[model samples]
Target chain A: MNILAMFKPNRDAKHYPGFGAVGVLFFTFLYLPILVIIAYSFNSNRIVSVWQGFSWQWYASALQNEGLLNSLRVSLTVALFATLVATVIAVSAALVLERGQNVKHAKLSQGVVNLPLMLPEIVFAVAILILFSQLGIQSGMLKLILAHSAFCIPFAFLPIRARLQGMDNNLEQAAQDLYATPLVTFRRITLPLIAPGIFAGSMLSFVISMDDFITSNIVSGGGATTLPVYIFSLVKQGVSPELNAISTLIMVASLLIATPCWLIAKRSR
Target chain B: MKKLSWNFWGLLPAYLVMSLLMVLPLLIIFYVSFMTSDAYGGYKAIFSLQSYSQIFYTADWDDNLVLNFQYLKIIARTLFLSGATAVICLLVSFPVAYYISRQSNNMKTFLLYLVTLPFWVSMVVRVYACVLILSNDGVLESGLRFFGLIGDIDSLLYNNAAMMVGMVYTYIPLMILPIYASIEKLDTRLIEAASDLYSCRMNTLRSIILPLCKPGIVAGFILVLVPCLGTVLEPMLLGGGKTMMLGNLIQNQFGVARNWSFGASLTVLLLCIVLLFLMFQAHRTSKLRELS
Candidate 1:
């Protein structure tokens, strides 16, 4: 404002054709590859490298790959189960942690909850591998659920904790004074208020579980493979159009979940 | 008032579950790292100083452990790249965020959603897109050649630079969200007040706006740095498999090497470094809050 007030208005926006060109280029560079991946999914040629006209055969073939489809199903199933389990633990932990009076211990509890996230994915993967092996627990769907659920709790807790921090205790106290049971008061007051944070946390946990390769790769035995591991293995073999097709599917799935949340967050703000 | 005791008991299930699932397993990892290797190096009950000693005593661990320095170099490089990413995101997103924040209801929401559109997509898929474009016959490589900007086909898929590109792409949303939050919190009148004082755009930005936004900047830095430290997979896939980054090494120990103890130490070391970074970040954020 001060600079504009002291001088004549300068509409330099038109003067430099290439002034913001760098940013435009940056956006294009960042986005163009993603656009190409979507575009080339229709490539009639088997080569991911060259465009030899367009067709949807790859998608049809990708869908027909039972092994790939099975893993995708497994990933989604595990992610869904993990999210629900994590949500319950996290919301409860967040409530108790927040409602409690001991600030020091609450912080410690927060630290412990976030511990799984801070540890390298490798360490957790190894720890679980050894722990499970020693227990003689066979690797299967159950093992993945157990392993993923361990990490998901913290993801569930962190956002809800943030929401919990901002909450006033008075509302709950008022409910208590009015003779409502603790359970009823919680449902009527705390849950509704913290619903958004729970939603955010669930979304985060689902994404983390769905995209997880390291822990799932390590802990789960040969029987189960997630989408990421499948994609990684196929990529190592070289980028088959099948892999490209799967990538497109994953891209679409993630985008589908993310777009709505983005809109909700933006609109709320 | 109802006693707080019963309510406090509600915390036990989560607390016990996390401690057993998380903390105890860590303890076991540290313990197993000390267990002696069997006759075939497969199974043993005997404790050996071998694993710990080998990391420093001889080439057995020296080769892999020394790789830490190389990976540390990569870690430093990754952090630098993330820092550059953070700075780039901050600069580019700030004005746009400011303008959006200043806009009327629906347009602002619609445009902000536009900014977040790509984030909705799986980051892995987007990263794979980068691979597709950078590969030998990928679009960008041929695009560059087609434009006559290069004489030969260039393959840019696997390298630290490409790794940085992936890291930046993954984290830009992180950087943006905080800056947007900070920008959103600023009162409209502050700009008007600065204008009343005849403050120039550059001066107001330097003295007033930037200072107020320091907390957000610090928060964004922590968010980026924490992930950058563990980003071995991105460099592995995107940088080409030749890059032996720390996360990859830690991953390999459990995967191929089967060395649990050494991996645990390396993980603990990384954990400590992140904790230190976060401590500094928290201090900066609190101080900035006090200043503004």
Candidate 2:
């Protein structure tokens, strides 16, 4: 009986009562609100809650808004700079911590780098806001870029570190046996091997920097707004179809960027 | 020696940025929390414990001090709501994760992808999606009225219950993914062996699976709990500014109230709570590691 059961289990073995129903309900709960947003984005009515008929008018209006455009510009600039700074430092940190066996305080350094991820984002935002103001840093864009880059480091660093750890040590050893210099070996072998991880990390941080609201909202000081901060301000006056149209656009754009990141991260794993 | 120096140079920039930008700022906040707030949203640089004391006491109209319950109530409400979110997420996530882990290889990948896809969508957008559904004459209201469930078109938004729905909606994926990861690693053969030995399913699950997946449940709980605690957008948007959370209270201190010192103190309190949770998680994880 044990041998037979080992080869083939009963039909109900994996089935937990009510699990299937709960799973189905869980997915519905997850997707229903998203679907409602997408549907309402096309509503012809001015008010977001009431649906009159299908129309693209809100999209047209959203595109023409100067404040929205400027916010998008600020968001893109911040994400670009933050992602660049974060990815470079992340690669350096990953290389050192993963391979430097004798590096002192390596565990402590890793913990410090990851502290932002563990704490509340509002705490960090409040801290950075105080830091910037105390130093009398007046440029809103500069404040945002600096703060976002600091927070994005761990998101970018973790994947690269994982990639480095998973790599076979023998390949580098074999290259060294062939008398290849450290820089040459790193450029030719190590860089290419972890390029996917670097890309994945960059993409992840870019999405994170763009999606940030609380930090940007607080740090921006209402001077240079990001897209999220802009959308949030609009919501204060109540939801509008124009806001819906802008939201749908932002969702689609993030999806377009994030899908490739997810695919690469999965495939590399 | 030269090679080690080169490695140290490579690591310095990363380490310096985190310390100077992130860690140093937190330290400054710690220092600033004890200072006094000036009239112009600036600091006085004078030592005071008034910021901390203000959390528990307030001056009455008679110029006598009284035990204040306002901030304490907000803190309690924040803890209650965040704790409830974690519990609800775990209950829903466990079954869903188990179901996903049991699927065929392709189905598992597809389901996991679906689970993670919403995470990419901006959180503000997702919260707004809740507003679209819960507001008066909204999609849910419209649908309900069509079914003749109610007469008047009243908004279901701007309450703690509505905010809870929004919180669960946004943070549920965080809960699901961690549990799925741990459940995916579970040894199915052990489960089959238990059943083969005449053990009932519930007994096997309770004894074997639950203990094995405890790490995941704990991880999922913390993952959901942390963000839910600090959430500002949900309370403001879904709760319609009526229900104030810790995040909202902090924002007000900085924004409208202009109490930089007080905000710093509140932030310090929040930081301590987060650190406590993280330390507890670390302890449990190490204990679990020693066991296995």
**Best candidate according to TM-score:** 2
Candidate 2 residue runs with Cα over 4 Å from true position: A1-10, B146-154
> Best candidate per lDDT, number?
2
Q: How high is the CA lDDT of each candidate model?
A: 0.71, 0.88
Best by DockQ: 2
Model 1, retained fraction of real contacts?
Answer: 0.37
lDDT of 2 by residue, B141-195 (tens): 8888889887774668898888899999999999998899888889988888888
Clashing residue pairs in candidate 2 (N, C-alpha, C atoms within 3 angstroms)? none
**Candidate 2, residues A1-269: lDDT per residue as tens digits?**
98887557445665677787899999998888887777888999877776699999999999999999999999999999999999999998888888765787887878877878998899989888989988999999999999999999999998898899888878887898999998888898899999989988898899999999999999996479998999988888787888888888988997898788878877877
Residues A9-113, candidate 1: write the lDDT tens digits. Answer: 543211222323444554566667767777777888887777798788999999999888888889998999999988898887787777855534776777777
lDDT of 1 by residue, B1-292 (tens): 2446644566665777677677777777777667764433234666866665544444534454332244456556655766676677666656555555655778766655656666656556767776776678677677788888866845677877777777777666666567768877766577667767787666767777777776677677677767777765577778787775667766776667766665655666566777788789768767766976
Q: Candidate 1 — which pairs collide? A: A2-B199, A3-B200, B158-B239
